[model samples]
Target: MSLGRRSVVTLAAAVLLLGGCGGGGQEAGAGAGAKVTVEWWNIVTTEPLKSIWAEKVKEYQALHPGVVIKNVPIENEAYKARLTTLNQSGKTPDIFTTWGGGVLKQQVDAGLAKDVSDEVAPWIGTMTPASLQAYQFDGRTYAVPADIGMVGFWYNKALFAKAGITAPPTTWSGLLDDVGKLKAAGVTPIALAGKEKWPGHYYWAYLAMRIAGLDALEQAAADHEFGGPGFVEAGRRLKELVDLAPFQKGFLGASYNTPDGQAATMGNGKAAMELMGQWAPVVQKEAGKDLGDDLGFFPFPAVDGGKGLVTDAFGGGGGYAVGQDAPAEAVDFLKFLSQAGNHREAVASGAVLPVVKGAEDAVKDPNLAVVARTLASATGFQLYLDQAYPPAVGQEVNDSVAELIAGRKTPEQVAQAITATAKSE
Candidate 1:
């Protein structure tokens, strides 16, 4: 999620497209007059999107010569909190980063975001439908997706070989066995940033998705319930991993990219694997030693008797939506950002997964390309649990799962905790 994130209570849908928000009421290049500045809010503060985005903004302004794009970059947690505050007043930047789900729906409900359908009609056919799913609701589009990807196991092949594990696991039992082997070989089996909660939640969420399937999770949300047997089973499976004591020391307090945290741990070759999305390798290199050719990726293994297929993917991507009062130029800038050539540059720079139909050829990273192709063939897709559910329920899921991983909560207790939160919401 170079442009998106794992945080919650932000995205939403729209039932009716808004008027005057059809996009492109102004000329492509503005005439000499007062400078029209587009207040752009986004979370591309990390590389390679950070640097690539800055250069692209400069080029767009240079091409227009009369538009000023003010970019307000924020971190993951901070971005969520800030947007939440602004959303209270029904205000957002002209072009803001959106994960494009219930948050976008809420924004549309509040009349705070523009309907981008009319503006994107011509070029919409050039992008993949799956990549565009999160941005659309009730037959209307609100956001332009920049990156699309799914989460899976990113491992160190060298470490796996050292552990005598010849291949990645294909079943839940095999995964546990592999973890034990890695530990016996003096390696931390998994790199987890427990303080962050989101990374750890991946385990239980993926387990739930595996045991319960995507449709079950959606149904649970619709009914505000998580005490289902599948959820308890998911937690019990995660507990088995936790019982092995596989994560790095101090994992409970670990940060995602800090020097001693998750990405760095794996990137530095101290851990065998991590369950992460397409950004893993990029952040691995950014935060620690580059794994180079030793890096490998595999889909999360199927449970022995699970409902989800190995073909089902779990993750989301980044997109941009306009404010309801945003100038048509704002929508124009979005178009500029998503043009096939521009998106190709982002792909080549290793900042994003391919979103446009033909941009997959632009991918330069082998690991990311694996993820791209995996997504291309996925039979089902699940946005991150946090981004998929209401904010409180999502956070509760994270917190309760963390407690379970720490041996502070039982599997039944965790499911009940999440159910309690969900029902209250």
Candidate 2:
């Protein structure tokens, strides 16, 4: 589906506003004896996270008396487009948030981002090897992780209880069984917002990971070799789930905003669960629901004899990176924000999982804590497809998945589109 008019207007306004801000150079705050200004951009849509990030910037400025931070809160779609323009024009922010893997690699290749290896290596020793590896490319580290998250089932505990599901499912059959029970109890087995496309794509990616294993899926995404048995099996399994009537009715027409309208269904116990990222709690809070006792989380169910275990998750987190053209003061400001105190504050206030070691101790929310533990225990990390491939190729994958969901394309057709893009790239 096309973006709403309001969204289009907002994106246009953001681009014009940012464009009028002029190319990178000295601004009002950059003068003799003035504070060093660092422009930082992020795509945080929810309330608590928005405030938390604002607070973090405030705290960073306080710690570095002579440094200033200009926090630009851009809408998600606009943020990517704006950053791309800035990167190409050599006017990117001094320090900005970036998704792990190919997203960062693209900027690194274009020489828009700085190699922060020396600046972050000492602290890197404390990071999970897999987490560190997610942002690394060609033996150089270009970004420092801000958090790690996982894709899982975020369910309503009370709904599960009312449906007589005593425990979360750990296997494919168990999940299907639970879905049946939930449906029989008049609850929507799953809440899916397919209009966004990415949310629907998550289902396919997670299913692919479960069926094909991390290595094979990564190879497929990286090399476009989806002809392997594991890859085909993944497509078949995802098709099975799609045919199960698991999603809410008219899901293909539902947008992320639909969840808010359907809040009563989920929050009032009409829907059992949603397969989503760790940010569900944040979304719940924004929807005006007291998610206290109702919320519970569990990893996606396992596939029998699958090379990967049930605990393996499919999601990507972001990190902070300084622009190569940033001034010395901007680099120093980035260093200040990376300190343990600032990072912890960001997590505690925003409910974000910290990328640094010892930062988890400060995450108070139960769900965030669970996410932190899951990420820490992860044996491998798969960068989200959109973030793992070049933007053009990533768009093809998303488009193919959307077409498949709309019944305009088959699994083989989608897989072939992906392979074709890989070959051309």
Candidate 3:
């Protein structure tokens, strides 16, 4: 069932035709007599997801005998650029993965996506309200989330034990104490790959959340009010962390691929922890280790007087959505893929937090189940800032974070630059 490059190209061409075939108001559940060809594009270069998607695609083909799925795995760095170009050329895939927050709003407004409200409504009541809201634009649904994840601290249990640390820290001061212990034990406290920019940017987002609360971070990113006391304090705290050398040597120059290779450093026992999304386990697996019994997780520690709550999570899922111009058959295939069972299967294979309710129970991996539980119990959820803001503003924030990490910009300079970008938008 492994599809070749030619098959992929052929499927993409069919998807293009399906996308250009407009004016037929056929429903998504059209009969099996119609053979649909769906061009499904996703960014899955990393492990677990890539292998998971490959399996899921095979299952989808078996279930829908007449349906042909064109799977295109886009590189993370090139996804946005290529997507934009494909969209402009009117060759956008019939069904593609998309972020579920304000990012989807832009596509909805541009009429690039189909309103899947009706198609997704049946499963709506089964999902968490926050999960449902993440995919909404103007009170209408444009996509169905396949996974829902939360950002938190992922630590190596073996490393903690070696350092004689018995429990995970629940407060800010406790976190610093643990970091000090790990540092004394000759272990890097955090594994940060700053060259990728977004990973370093995550530190800022979490710090901002701890200092100002979710509302302030949201407003600052959305409204550009970066001069507030909350932001300044967050920036100061970030600088303190940076000064501590919590990260590995030469971390600033290391890429995401570096962390994956340095698996022994983080997974076997060299690093104590990483502040990352729930997807860290997959990354660890890619590093050639099982990570069994050595993994543990905890929410980010609370800032002493900050307004943010420990229950607030920062992360969102991307899901598959059909194009408005897609052919009737392709649209039908998209709907088939959204069925509860299919969706759950897809998520379970990917080790992703499933958007469907029962899928959490279906998760065999304890780590993934922990992620699901966290997402299920979160009091509030915020999409990643880059995915929450307009593309231009997001790009500016990414660059600012990169410069901040490189020591090329002061905290004040980064804050001011972010505010300027928000105001200009």
Candidate 4:
């Protein structure tokens, strides 16, 4: 499970290829020298991305003195609701955040998104191709990615040692055993934001990926069915963990970035680990004490005899897409943000995983570097289920999985619920 130098070198090679954007007709400050306002929306209410993004806005405005970039930072779930509402109302912010999968596809289909293929072509070649995969459609680009990463277990090394565990687990059964050992050592084995629903879905999603294989999930989605035996087994496996009572007390009511929530629980050492994405460490530090050297990361363990390999990755990153009605400055601003110098600031802040060529060096956090390496060596990649599937179907997966975790639904029922929803969609 150790991410070796080979993987790191692989990642370095992937990001070292040669390319900038916003060059043709209008510059970022164009418009008869009159002041232009660009409303940029993103889910960055938390630091260090929040502050770093704000500084970038200021810097952009400073350089393009005639442009006023309005930065709107929203909380995670709230941002989803707000954006959904806007989309339903036939409106969108000038520039907004996107996960760049089914949701982005829907927007493009509805004519709510802009195609930036030509605008970004000059520099898109410089980015990691995998990072751009989610944002591209019909051989055209729809968004500019600023971050890229995967979801995995962020664990406490000290807590693992206290539980007499010498190495991270590589198999599902080993992970369960380690959970038990941690609990026996009087530690809350895992911190989960059950109330958030999405975080809870990661467990089920990763389990499904590990058990059913990546191709199976994709086929299931395409077939509008999720009630296959493999998916049911994935739920049963999650149920096995849930039955162990591994999460922190009141986990069902916990938020993600709040003071008493998942990241905080893991950050304060109230729990040994959390299944989250690359942002986990940053939020943990912001919401609670910095674990510093005690922090460690490991990929999700593989299920024994499963079709999936241990190297398959499950996650996605944040990207920016311009609205159809947005002014050209919106695209220009995205180009400006995509510049290595500006983006390196976010990467250096440990808030972004490198997407730009030569930007990998900006990743200073060891755990994040491990993520980058592991991602590079992945045998397959699946975007987060909630993003990979249509909005309704993805929400159904989250809701059904949450019910399964809450002990209100059987493994079979969880699969059935998801399948039913997918079919209706």
RMSD of each: 5.0, 4.4, 5.9, 8.6
Instruction: Please give the ranking of all candidate structures by lDDT, highest first, separated by commas.
Output: 1, 4, 2, 3
Scored by lDDT, the top model is: 1
Q: Candidate 1, residues 105-150: lDDT per residue as tens digits?
A: 7788889888889988988888777688778877999988888888
The Cα local distance difference test for each model comes to 0.83, 0.70, 0.69, 0.82
Compose the digit string of candidate 3's lDDT tens values, residues 1-425. Answer: 00110011111112221223222333367774755666777776666667767776787789777766777898644565566656655445677767755456666766777897776565566766556656676678777666677778889888888778999998877888888898888778888777667767777777788788877876676566787888777767777777777887777776654444333346645578887777677666666465778898888888888898878888766666677776555556555555677767766565466776666676777776787877777788877777777656666667887787677887888888888887997
TM-score of 2: 0.84
Model 2: residue 335 alpha-carbon error in angstroms: 3.1
Off by over 4 Å in 4: 1-89, 325-332, 376-379
TM-score of 4: 0.81
Global fold similarity of model 3 (TM-score): 0.81
In candidate 3, which residue ranges exceed 4 Å CA deviation?
A: 1-82, 259-264, 288-290, 327-335
lDDT for 143 (candidate 4): 89
Angstrom error at residue 251, model 3: 1.3
The ten-residue window of minimal lDDT in model 4 covers: 3-12
Worst 10 residues of 1 by lDDT: 15-24
Cα deviation at 50, candidate 3, in Å, is 7.8
